[model samples]
Target: MNQLQNQVSPYLLQHKDNPVHWLPWGNEALDLAIRLDKPIILSIGYAACHWCHVMEHESFENQQVADLMNEHFVCIKVDREERPDIDHIYMDALHQMGVSGGWPLNVFLMPDQKPFYGGTYFPKSNWLQLLNSIQSAFQNHKDELQQSADGFAANLEDKSIGLYPVELNELTPIIPEVLAKISKYLDPIFGGIQKAPKFPLPSLTLFIESFPEKLDTNFDVYIHSERQLEKMAQGGIYDQVGGGFSRYSVDSEWFCPHFEKMLYDNAQLVYVYSKAFQRTSNPLFEEVVNSTIHFLNRELRDSSGLYFASLDADSEGIEGQFYVWEFEELNSIIPYEKHAPFYQAFQIKRNGNWEENKNILFKNHSVLNVVYEKELQTLATVRAKRIRPQTDTKLLLAWNAMLGSGLVQASKGLNNHKFLENAIALEESMIGFWDIKNNLLLHQISYSNQPIYAFLDDYGSYGLFLIHLYNETAKVIYLEKLRKIVNGVYQNHDQMNYLFSFQSNLNAALISNKYEITDSVIPASNSMLCELFFWSGILLNDVTYTLRAKDMLAAVLEQAAANPLYHANWLRVYSEWMENPQALVKYNPSNYAKNELPQLRVTWVPIVDQSHAFLLCIGDRCLSPCESIDELLNQYNSI
Candidate 1:
């Protein structure tokens, strides 16, 4: 009687055998809770989330705990990825309750699905205590909780409705100032935007693409940003031993990382570094880019071609156990002659780098100055033997799309065919497995043969990826696929004005649902959809997509134009359209001469269909696509 057997989310299926009569988040679960007059215990998590798995194994699977849950409460399970709207609402409630929200989020809701209390995780004893207390409150103080639920629901509905205004045209002009504020938020010493426990800031990185023109020649802001990036690249947050980056740094100095390796972070960072390489021609940026891609190829990618989601932050139930090492271990690995200088330079004391006896990682910035010295190579060789952390092998569509775009960027900037080849391979993998039919992409693919339907973000992101890759490779297959997916998204989600809604057909089954619009780590799907439409129109030489793109852009134009600084996504679209509002088609990537000319601002639409592999040069007067890569190079050289 495992209710989750019919569910698609792997996270939900992990609790299938629990004695608790777990219901998937739907109208049925809400209706049951209302009918039974019981509090709803809603648990939210994703499959790749380690803590989510840990909580599942510890409590959700325990028969006694399950029995308690089944008898006293109506338990429900939700996958955060499958339905971000539900997760967002509950997470907001948790935040409002003054708790920092995280995966394995457990919320106590009234029969009406209004969350009254939520905490990330609790041990068995604490969980039991809370459950007992909650049951008591629900039974004895029922009217108070009911009143609170009513209030909560009204406030939540109002919040969701207020998030997306009907007219946003007034806000676009101020985008520059908000973007500057974002830049100001960057830690000059450390790499990330904020303080400790920093996220990779992929959203910010994408936003950086629009700022080069605004920056000065010395690019002080740009230099500061690059310096922060370099600090991070050299720091332990980036796997110095491995090629990929971890989830984020625990401390602001980028000294200690959480140790989880995410495919999305690396992919996005790679794209950022590649652009940095092109912008500055910095050798350090190039090295980081190469090393990152090396890590992606070596560990994260599956044989079938799609990239995995993330590596766990902890292994064998001990956080940082796999990645950390003792000083003796490093000493044993290093030769006698090289040990002293290496140890001193890295701040490696006899005790250790992190928790006294255990080594985290340390990099001497001075090493860059002396990297050519003979001692450096010998030290690097010895340091490679430590045990690395395990990787999460779940392939995610959104992540793969990010990687695809990264490869295209790397290829464009580095002129590396290998990068292009890897991009193609990964894209092929996504198309092969996630394409479902000729129309849609799936969200996740696991080894257990379970195929989950993609969410709004996945489809939007994947579509963006296809378009970017087509721009790079100009492969017909990619463009055609891009066309299909874009049209598919419009078919699947568009109600009227082309403002993309996150809720899909599957979400209609939910008893009480709400629409929301706050771009989380990634930009909103509708924002991405608009960008895709603009680029698609320019690349395909189609006016219909262009008109749609105009409407989409106009929809947000006023807000974006008025306050474009805060709206990074809108600024990015503006950057693309800046050259010629009407003559966007004149900036096609397939034009060889036009494509090769560096120093000109570059914006590419994904060209999927196999068009001529030449570069199109957009000058003051004419248009002709160069026939060959060398020809394009020759034109740039002449210029």
Candidate 2:
């Protein structure tokens, strides 16, 4: 019987009726592997992964392949979104085997749960051969395989902290040097790195925006960052008719995306674009922000104010089916008069701008003013009639918190209090998922049931969001909530070498207490923890928090300097640390004007002090309170 029938994860459910008897990852499956004396086929993938669906259709659903798999292995299906801990463990194991990591990651693990061999996405023919070969190896050379697994298991101990040794960071001006190194990879003509299959890693642009007041010896990082943002805003990766961005482009030109829309990516991109708008007053940035927010509201949001995980990359058994458009489809929808400009602007080709004789809408950055606003709405109205991509209904706390954080930041950029209000509403909803006394957080908000515990990223991200809220609202309650989360991370998580832990659960997995030191598509949980500690330390007036936060950044500074793209989040924190971020204790709610200052140095610590004065503080030290906002601004500018 397929044990996955009971699972809430869409990915697991996708395989529930498969000919292979797939069990959700649990002790039952592991014990079955041991009892049957069989190797474990641990398949990990997320709901929205196009290849995951492909593999399911090609192999798992094939009765012949299923017979081979069922006879040899106790197959365990894990939705990476539902069980990131298990995913991280096996994915790391795959990496330790010197394989580049991706989904759907298929690993052959021992009954003891240590991964011996792994590879991603195999054809049915290869998979069949692999199953027989692996089964033969297990029967004949069990001892040798165990030893190899042991070696890989030992190397898994080198998770983040052990792999990247904690150095005695100089706390000197490393930003200039790091920026110089990063400048080498920046695709100046287009926005992102000079590599194909580009991701809109907001961290890179965000880091460029984090230049201190004094780091102006050379390099206009803003221009390069702006160019990238503008390119993305005008690219196919960003949905032109609809709102929100796809996962990433499959090309350097941002012409074709992988087309999975993750809540985290959209959330992070919104925050990045808002900052861009704040700095440059670019209407495109504002429009993108507004449109993306609308996308989130209309599609992703549950009436409860939390969001769903992602939109699947595949629709109707075809990737990009929902998002891409045919040439004639555009011709029929657009008016005859506007067809020329619309086709010219969107670069729609009769043979398709993308695969399958369809166009992925995008405009050349030079011709962004070629108007098609009314035509886009018409297209959206028509496109709305097609079958939509499946939404992964799992409402992750980390993702929701990120969107909340983005909304707060957006409120600043758009000069609209509505964003902040929306953020507050989201908090009201998400706060229900937390068990503050036990330091317990549900992995995702669910209308029915939430069986998973929140991971380290969830805690760190929620804490970071609370920090943003506290600053924006001057609500001491947000800081108090942040303190609880910080305490939870400190007490609940087992430390990895000298750095922070990767997840909230201590006993969930078999091996590796990893530290997420570098940034990926989303900022690492530890980087968020660093921010959490930095602010909680500053605002809460705790020296322990400050020192711990500083140590976290210290551990990654050298590595972060070496490769800033993967460590851009850490670089942002390091840059802020070097600047000695000052907190301004304002007696009123922080408006957009105060927060959006160019090269702003002070962090807002809002309080309803009876005397409407501004208190400037650095670490624990504070200057005399200023009499007025003007005086504070003047004083801050001079300093």
lDDT of each: 0.67, 0.81
Clashes per candidate (backbone, < 3 Å):
48, 0
Model 1 lDDT on a 0 to 1 scale: 0.67
In candidate 2, what residue range of length 10 has the lowest lDDT sum?
590-599
Give the TM-scores of the predictions, in the order they appear: 0.82, 0.94
The TM-score obtained by model 1 is: 0.82
